[model samples]
Every structure is written in C-alpha cells, then in structure tokens.
Target: MLFNSYSFLFAFLPLLLVSWRLAQGYGPTGLALVLLAFSTVFYGLWGLPFLIMLAVILGMNYAFALALAAPEPEQAQPAATTEAGSEGEAEAQAKTESACMCGSRKQGGCRFRLSRKSLLGVALVLNLLPLLWFKYSAFLAQNLAALLHVQWHFTSPGLPLGISFYTFIQIAWLVSVYRGQVTPQGFTRHALFSACFPYVISGPIVRYEQMGQQFDALSPITAENLAKGFTLFTIGMVKKVLLADSIALYADSVFNAAEKAFPLSGGEAWLGSLCYTFQLYFDFSGYTDMAVGLALMLGLKLPENFDSPYKSTGIVDFWRRWHITLSSWLRDFLYIPLGGNRQGRFMQYRNLFLTMLIGGAWHGAGWTFIVWGALHGSMLSINHFFRACIKGKTLERILALAPLRLCSILFTFFCINLCWVVFRALTIEGAGRMYKAMFAGPFTREAAGLSATTDGLAGFAAMVARWLPNNYIQGWIPFALLLVSFFVVWALPNSHEVLHGRRDGSHPRLGWRPTAAWATGLAVMAFLTLILVSRKATFLYFQF
Candidate 1:
C-alpha cells in the first residue's frame, strides 16, 4: 500500500478519491465515515492482526475520552445563587463561576475528572504496550540474556507498520484530552484521525488540537487544491524514485560490503557515507511531501516536516529544520514536562540529553541509534555552551560575519554526516569499520593496491565482484547528479515554497504557479516516476 506503488497510484487512490467526492453530497458525517472506512481498508492491507490491534486501541482511547468529557450532575440548590447574599459569599461565587467558564471543576463538581486522569494514564500505558512488545522486546531479551549468561531463546513479534508514529499520535491525543486542550469528537472523526493513511506510515505527526477543526470543516474539493496536491506528489515522486533510490545503490553497495567484512578504501568510505546522507534526507523528506500532498488532495493540511536542514549553521539550527514535527513533539510532550529550560542550565542540558536518547531509541531497537542520539545530544549541549560564551553584542557581531557562518554550516554538515554513518550501519561494529576506513584508510588506488584496474566492459567483471562499486558509474555522471541534488536542496526553493507561491518565513525562494507550461512539466515527471515505480523501494522511515 505504498503511495509510490502502482496499485496505490492507479487503483486505490483513484477509487478512494472518487468515493470520497461522491460521499460529500451525503453531508459531513457521511464524508467522514467514508474516509474512516477507506483508512480502515488501507490499514488492513498491511495485516488483519495489526488492524484489529489498531481498532482495539482506538476504541479504548475513545472510551477514555468520553469518560473524561462526561458532564457532572447539577447541584440541587445551585451554589452560585445560594451564596449570592453576603459579600464574601459573592466573591466565592465569582471564583466558582470563573472556574466553570475556564472548564475546571470546583468543590462538589464532577469526580469524573480525577477518575478520567487515571483512566488516561492507563490508556497511555496500554497503547504503548503493543509498541514495546513488538518493536523492542527482542532487543531487550537478547541484552538481558547476554547479561545473565543464559541461553534463553525468544522469537520476535512482527512489528506493525507505523506503530511508532501512531503510538505517538495516540499519546498526544490522550494527553490533550486529559488537559482539556481537544474537544472530543464522534467515533467516526476520531477513527479517521487515528488511522489517516497518508501519514500513518511515515508522519509529520499531526496533533488533534491542530487538526481537529480541519477534520470538522470538510471543504468541497477544489481545482486549486487538487492541482497543488498533484504538483507536490509529482515532485516527491521524482525525489524518491529518481534521486534517493539512485543514490541508495552506491550507499547500499559500500555498507553491505562492510557488513560482509570487506576492507574499504577511504574514497569508497566517504563516497558511500555522503551518498547515504543525501539518500536518507531525500527519502524521508520525499515521503513527507507525498504524505502532505495526499492529505491536501483529501482537503486536509498537514504540518511541514523539513525546512532545508542542510542549510543550518549549527546542531541546534539543524534540529529546528530537520524533522520539525518530531522535534516539536518531543519538546512539548517530553522536554517541557520534564521542566525544560525553565530549570537551571544543568537540568536543561540533562533534559536535552535524555529527550534525544529516548528519541533515538524510538527510531529502532539498537545501540547504534542510541549512540547516534547521544552524539547529537552532546553536540547540542556543546552548541548551547558555545552560544553562551558569545552572548549579547559579541553574538550579534559574530553572526553578522558571512565567512564564519559558512564555516559553521560546513562544520555542522560534516558532524551530521559522521552521525549518519552510525545511523545507517547495520551494527556498531560495522559503524566502527566504516568510520575507521573513512578517517584513517588509504585514499589512493595505488596505496590500496587497485592501480591496475581497467576501464569499460573489461572492468565490469572486477567491479561486479566488488559489489558493483560506485566507480563503475564512470566519468562525472554520479558527481553531476550529486551536484544537482545540492543545488535543489540548498539553492532551489523547497516544496512548501512551491506550493505557497511565495517565501514563507526563512524559506526565501521562488515558487511555482499554475500554468499550461507547468502542467506539461508535471506530466513528464509523473511519467518518469511511473517508469521507476516498478523498482518498488519502500520509504526509509517505514522501518521505524
């Protein structure tokens, strides 16, 4: 059920769009149900067992929300009126009315709020249980067995697709309900929010408070929105099929060779790592564009996930741009609750470290991810410390220098590239091997004993034996493509700018407009994407 797949492009999406439009005539509730039913079918495509698990989780959360939203019985004498006689009584009555208006309870008010808080806590744990069991149980068990020196055996449960994303969404929803930030919707609307297929697999992680009103106000499909969505989807398809997948060939070759204990020359190591860095960026960001486009087609607006992260001048800036939604989610739900920056500097650093550590582990059940998270966390702490050293006038003067800014950007990108090696490796040992080769191994072919290698068809056999090494591409073709990707990422406007027809915030660039010429271009991109879709590569974030 990948959005890039033929069945989704030619069959599921077309049929679903048609059915959704027709259902709009039946009114909002009917349209919502149609979406919910379609989302159910989409989820079921992954597996019935996981679908059933999702349904149960949704039902429990809905029930908990209903309990949280239940109204209390009115007092017999009406406390406000009864206490209106004396001045002190009137003051107390005013406070009571204020509390009620603010959606809080006073004395003799609903006991349901207390009970609901407990229920919400239980619901959060219950929802996370499936994610823990499926995603992390094997890692935990194996580690425990090694520590205890036991020969215990355990079979891993199949991971449900999008469990990490949906689980976070559900947790956010439950917390919002408990905090009275979100108004409870009917089962149909809630179900649609929980299972919306566009972002279910790889998400921008939309919050209920942000999107609830959009869900309620279902506008009729318009030509403008449809065109915008199609354009975004086309652009995303080109990024994924044409760019990301192509780079993945070189990256996979080198990494897979390393995994098989092959010694890599320094050139091969760096080439592979750089290829992977761009591959991951385009892969995840490209998927996000497609998701946002799909939601737009259905008349829903999702939050932007990326903002030219590579242009960031520091680790802190990088986090702000890369995976914007997830970073915000972690800040609001995890960091803020743990006292955030309101606490002392030491505590703030501690919170930052812990948040990233957990965030890394959430990506997958591996120590490599943990170390990757720790590296970023440490860099962020150091960044903050460095900022503190040049505060006020000095900071402003330093930032005004363009060369310094460029150097910072380059340094930050290099640090990020090193982290990606850890993130992409199959194991920590593989990561070590790759890093050793990247930093210390010989760079020249003569030094590495490959100076006699031939060119053209004659060399194909040797290159094939070396896992079809990246050098097989010949000439400047690969470098040309890499240059093109850099131009698109750093020089060209992003998808958001193109959609909005103007620069939005820090994204200062030109945008696309509806025109006959643009339509023809989109059609060609679509055709090229279709030709490449036969390769059927899954989006990178799908593993999480």
Candidate 2:
C-alpha cells in the first residue's frame, strides 16, 4: 500500500501503531513476530498467490543458509587425526565453536569448514533466476521469435512486489552470513529483518549485522524519535504531493508529445526535460524520507537514501550526494568484490565499467535503462580521470576565483541534466531527437518555437502558433515548491549529523521541542496530503 494513500495513512498506520506499541511490552521476539506478520499482510495486499510465492523464496533462501552451515559427514572427522592438522587447524576449530572452552574442554574438534564461495554461488543463482524470468522474459522471447522465423509470444510472469529489493537484501544477507558477521539469532528474527515492509518496497538496504541487536531488543517509544520521524514524514509528504507531482504534469505532456512529434521546439522540449529531472529527484527522495520516518515510528532506524545531489560540484560528488544507499550498496557488494582498488589501475577501471553496466541493467529490462546506466558510469569514469590529472590544482584554482566555482556548479548541473534525458526517454531515438532539437535547432524567430508578433514578419505566423507561454508559476506550482524545498534542505544540518545527535546522548531534556516538532510535522503533512488526495499518482521508481 502507498504511504500517500488514505487507506494506508489513516486506517492501516493507526492500526499498526497501536499493535506495535502493545507488542513492545511483550519483548523483542514477540515484537518481531508481530512485525513479521504485519509485513506479510502488507505484502499480501498485492495478492495471496504472490505472497505465497514470496514466502517460498524466503524459505528457500533461509534453508539454503541453514544447509550451508549444517555439518557434513566428512566434516565430522577429528582434526587431530588428519595428517595436515596443526596449530592453525586447532585455532580455527576453536574459533568456529566457543573460543572460551575449546582448549580447556579437551574435546576433539571438527575439521569441517564452511565455504563462502559455495554459499554465495547458491544465493546468486536463487536471486538471479526469478529476476531473469520476470524482468527479461519478454526481451528473450522477442529475440527467440526473430531467430526462429516464426510467430511466438510469452505471457509475462508474475513479479512479486518488492522482488527487486528482497533479492538484493537476501544477497547481502547471505554475504554477511558467509563472512561470519551475522550473530546468533532465531530464523524468525532474520526473516523479519529481511522482509520488513517499510524498507521492502523501496529500500535503503539495511545490513543484517547492523539490525541483529535491534531484532533481539528495542527501546521504548521516546519523544525524540517521534519528533524526528514526524518531521521527516511531513517534509517528505510535501516534497511528493506539492513538488514532484506538479512537475510531472509538464513532464508527462512533453514526453507524450515527443513520441509523435519528431522534434520539439524550445519551450516544450527543454522545459519538459527539465521537469522530468526535477520530478524524479523529488519523487524518489520523498518516498525514501517517508520510509525512513515510518521505520523510526516503529522504533527502527533505516538508512538515509539521499543528500542534496543538485548542490554537488562534480559528477563524483553527485553520486556521493544522490541515492546514497544504492551507491554504497554497489560499492560494497559489487565494486569491492571485483578486487576493489587493490588490483592496480587497469583492474580498477575494469571494475568501474562492469559495475556500472550491471548497475544500468539493474534499473530495468529496457535498452533505455541500460543506456542511462552507461551514461552515468561513463561520467563517473571520466570524473575519476579528470580528478587524477588536475589533483588539488583544479579546486585551488577555482577557490581563487568565485566565478570559476559558479561556472563549475552550472556545468555540473548541465551535465547531470543531459544524462537525465537518457533516463526519461522512452526509446533511444527519442533521446537522440531531444538532443538534436536542444543543440542544432535555430535560436531565433519561428524556428525557436517562441511566439512571434505579426509585426515581426509574414513567415513567422504558422510556427509561432505552436509556442506556449514560459511563465514558470502558471504551469508548475511544484517548481516553486522545489525552490522552497531546496531552501529547507540547505537550511538543515545533514541527516547523518542529525542522526548522530540521537546516538551521542546529546539531547537529554526529553521535553517540548521534540513534541512540538512532531506536532508541527504531522499538521503540515496532513494538510498537504489532503491537497493531493484527489490526484492519483504512482511513485516514480515504481515503473522501473
């Protein structure tokens, strides 16, 4: 269910809040069971069959891990009896069991060792099979039709909701388990950690180890967490309802018109593209904010997804600022695994390329998605090379000149905007036409697609008929909202810094400030939610 929906916001959330608080008095295990059931119900809203399918997959993954950790017959042999047995074997065995009693107990140690590679292979296969079946089935089917020289079609497979996130979560969980980072915990807790609803649909991708203790225990609902969560949820709601959806109006018109019109003139082409760029940023980031806030309401801390990406001065900085969770996920799970920076310069470049290509493919099953990923990947690599060549000299030179820094920021934004064309376009041809119109078209008179007065000339009348007013305020209120939103984002301290306050034990009062913030946040959010309720809108990334 959508967080923005009335049913979710009013009915479901209230019920959940009451249930969660009541369950909290029981204990962690009880709370986890409650959460697990709640998560399943949330997911089950899609359909009963899909929920069953998801359950089977989750069960398979959990069982696979158990199988990997289970002792084998060959592993039951005493280590001392083996010819290769030595101090290393004894120490390894001790660490595998209980370190405290290994030597003192005077018991023969088992020689079996769990293979990380084996476990990872199983996890990757399990995750990849369903992803391929659902996401790429149509692509493959079309290819097969052409190759066979016959008519053929395939029905689309049932894609479980949040499969994209759950797949990645399981992959990460398996890696942590293989690395021995996972603490001893019951299977119910592990299941809850992986399938928790707030993060499941669109994730900040929580790590298994970070949540291990939270699954075992939780703190009571405090004024501080409530205040912070309410503030975040309110801000996010405003971003989604007021800012993102408004831009989407113009974006939808322009892109829809582009599919039929070969090339668009200035106002429709450029402004439309710009609308999409802004729309996507607010929509995705807004959803993440709400998700984080909701998790906090439940006394769980989810990761932050975005920083101010537009404020970034370079492409490298842009990645660091945008979709932080996904970026870090790619870095930790994919980039580091491909030998990281340790294998020398050439391998580093190779890893960058491969990671980006895969990352692009991850966005969708379409060529447009692939191109979008490639565009960003190439930008990142170029930025790396540019940094190496300039060293500190580039920034130092810019610092000496204010206009230079300004130019750099503008250039970075323009480049990022250019990349968004690939992301927004429905087809590769559509992207090419948009770019052609943007760069090669005439800049004046009728050709520019701006309105021309009759006094100007006779030749201008026909083309000028197509021109639309450029008043920013009349068409897109959300554009104005974005201006306010950006001001707010810049006004606040970084989320990580704000989060640090909660952990550092700095705010000792537990008084009115927290309560006031929550109240204000809730009021603003409720007001905005009411305003946007009439328009049915889907989350931007839901298409992917």
Candidate 3:
C-alpha cells in the first residue's frame, strides 16, 4: 500500500480516481461513499484483523461523540414575535433575553460540561488501548521484569500499521467534541476522516475540523489540481528515489558497521552522521510531499508538515519547522494542558521536559528515544533560559550579528545531527560507540579495534592502509553526495516554495511551472522514480 509502489501508482490510484470521477455526478454523498469504500479496502489490505480493530475504534468514537452531542440543551425561551413599541419595552425585552441566555448557560454548565468531559475521557482511553498494547507492551514488560527481579516471558503483539497516528487523530477528535469545537459528523464522514489512505499511514496527523468541510464538499478533480498534484508528487519522488535512498546506502553501511561494533574513524563517523541527517529529512519530508500531493489530487488539502527545519537557528525553531503537525499537536494537547509557560519558569521547563519525553516515547518503545527526547528537552530549556538572560543584555546585541546567526544555525544543525545518532541507532550502546568514534582522536583507530599491530603511528598507518583500498572512492562519493544534498537543502527552493511561486532569496534558480517543458520533466522524473521503486523500501515513519 505504499504510495511509491507501482501497484498503487498504476492500479489503485487510477482505479480510485476513475471511480470517483464516475461517481461525482451522483452527488457529494455518493462520492464520499466511494471514498469511504476505497479507504476501507486500503486498510483491509494491511490485515483484516487490524481493519476490524480500526472499524471498532471508529464506531466506538462515533457513538461516544453522538452521545456527547445529544445532551446539548436547547434554548430555554423562544424569541418574541412582536416588535417593541417604546424604549422602555425594548429594554425590558433585552433584559428578558439576557436572563434566558444566562439560564441556558447555567443549565449547560451543570449538566452538559461534566458529561462531555467524562465521555471524552472514556473515548480517549478506549482509543489508546490498542496502541498501548501493541506498541509498548514489550518495553513495559522488560522494564517491569528488571525492577522486580523476575524473568517475564511474554510474546509481544505485532503493532498494527498507523496505530499511533490514527489513535492520536481520534483522541484529538474526542477532545474537540468535548470542547464543542467540532460537531459530531455522522459515522460515514467520521470513518472517512479517520481512514483516508493518503494520511492513514504516516500523517500530518490531520484533524476532523480540517477535513470535515472538504468531505462534505467533495468535488470532481480538476486540471489545475492534477498538474499541481503531479508536480508535487514528482518532486517528492525525486527526493526519495534520487536523494534519500541513494544517501541511505552510505548511511546504512556506516550504521551497520557501528551496530556490529566495527571501529570507525572520526571522518567516517561524521560523514555517516551527516548522510543520515539528510537521509532522514528527505525520507520523511518526501513522504509528506507525496501524501499532500495525493490528497490534492483527490481535491483534499492536507496541512503542511516540513518547512526547511535544517535552516533553523534554534531548537525551538527546528521543532516548529520539522514535523510541524506533531509539534503543534503536542503543544496544544500535551504542553498547553500541562500549563505551558503560564505558571512560572520552573513549570514551563517541567512541561517542556514532560511533553518531549512523551513525544519521544510516542515514536517508539525504546530508551534511546527517551534519551533523545530528554536531549531536546534539556536543550530547549537551556535555550529558553539563554533567551531570557539575553533579553535586555549586550550579549543579545552580539548574537544578532550575521556571523553569530550563522554559527547558531550551524550549532543547531550539529546538535540535531548528534541527536539523530540516538534516534537511528539499534541500541544506546551502539549510539555510544558511534559518539566515541565521532569524538575520538584523529589517529586513534586502535582504540576501536581497527588495528592491533602497534601502539603508535604504525598502527594508524596500517589502519589507513586497510581502509584506503576498500573505502577510498566509497568515502568520497558520500561526501560528494552530502555536498550536493547540502547545496540543495540550503540553496534550492523547497517543494512548497517552488509550487507556491515563492523565490528562494538565497539562491534563485529554475522554478516549477505548469508548462509543456515542465510536464515532460515531471514525466521523466516519474519514470526514474518508478524504475527505482522496485527496491521497495518503506518510509521510516511507518514504524512509529
């Protein structure tokens, strides 16, 4: 069911589009039903059991939302039909209306609010249960076993695809319903919202409010949307096939070496880390592009996700740019509720730490992820403190200089790169080995077990001899590719900029336009991506 797969591009999408176009004449409801049926088929492709789970969750949430909506009290008084004859009469009428409004508010406050909150809590727990069992059971069991000094043997259940994403989406919906931010759409629209194939897997973590109107107004596909969608999809395809997968070769080799406890030179460590940094960016961002494109083709608009995160000068800025949806979700749902800087300096820091800790755990069931989250949390807290300290100081003026700004950007990128090591590693020990090699002395390959022949320059030379013959060109290629990636990332206009007609001030180049020439170029890019799609790699975020 990967969008990159030929079966999807050639078969599923085409069939669905044709069916949708055919159904458009039948009206929006018919078109929506078509979409819902196709979405169900898509989910069913993963596994019938999981599809059943999704259906039950959707049904349960829909039922809860309906119940929550039902108890909404009606207006207590009807409007008066006769017009006021005098000023005194008008004032008396206004007072009566005000009193009625106040009484209605009191009634809703006493009954509706408490019931809605209880229903939302129930829905949240029910929706999250599957995610908890499938995603975290192993991590919990192992930790509990260690603490109690008992060997706990339990077979972990397989995690259903997109469980984390869909669960979060539903939770957001429940909360919105409780707060009266979203009205309960019927089962059909709610189901479609939850299971839209483009986002059901890896997502921008869409909200019901964002897509509910579009679902009701589902329109026929248009040439403008088609061109824009195709262009976006092509750009994403090139990024994934040409850039991410190509860099992944080098990144995989180095990470695999580290996993095997192979000794790494400092040069190799940095190069590999850099490759992985770009690899992850292109991989996840590329997926987001395809998702957005696919949604656009269907006349639906998904929220933007990535916004050139590497260019960020601070950790907070980086989070705002990278995984924009997830960050916003955590802020609104977790951080704000936890008193998000409103309480005091200490509470703000505590909230930030806890939010990131939960955010990291949401990615996977591993201590590495927890530590990675902690790293960002700690840095963000320090960043906030630094900002506070510099608010009215001469140091603030110094940091605003161009060179300082560039240094800040580089420093932020470097910190992010280091964090990615923990995020990508198989274990904390593996990440530790990589970090040690990354910071080791230039000629100290011996400590990593690369050479045992001598203690001095001879051992270094022997290590060099062993590495040079095999990796000389291999090493250079990744560095060269890394340079190209850096140029593209820092210089070229991103997909959003190009598609939206914004110029890249830093490096103006050819921009995307819907012309015959551009169309041909897009076709060629699509062809090349199709050729590479046989490699059949899934997106990195799919695991989460």
Instruction: Name the best candidate (by lDDT).
Output: 3
Sorted on TM-score, best first, the list reads 3, 1, 2
How accurate locally is residue 66 in candidate 3, as Cα lDDT from 0 to 100?
A: 79
Question: What is the number of residue pairs that collide in model 3?
Answer: 0
Superposition error at 96 for model 2 (Å): 17
TM-score of each model, in listed order: 0.87, 0.83, 0.87
Model 1 per-residue lDDT tens digits across residues 136-178:
9999999999999999889999999999999999999988877
Q: For candidate 2, lDDT tens digit of each residue in 317-362?
A: 8888888877888999999989877887678777887888788888
Clashing pairs in 1: none
Q: Going through the candidates in order, what is the number of backbone clashes in each?
A: 0, 0, 0
Off by over 4 Å in 2: 70-116, 144-150, 392-403, 444-522
- The per-model lDDT (C-alpha) reads 0.82, 0.71, 0.84
Choose the strongest candidate by TM-score: 3
Candidate 2 RMSD to the correct structure:
6.5
lDDT of 3 by residue, 1-544 (tens): 8788888889999999999999999888988999999989988998999999999989998988876665444433444556634554545444434423232434223212334466567778888788999999999999999999999898999999999999989989888887788998678889999999889988989998899999988889999898898888888888888889989998888888888887666667778888899999999999999989988888899998988899998998899999999999999999999999999999999999999999999999999999999999998898988889889899999998999999999999999999999999989988988898777554546543564546576776665554332331264677788998999898887788877755344423566666899988888889899999998788899998
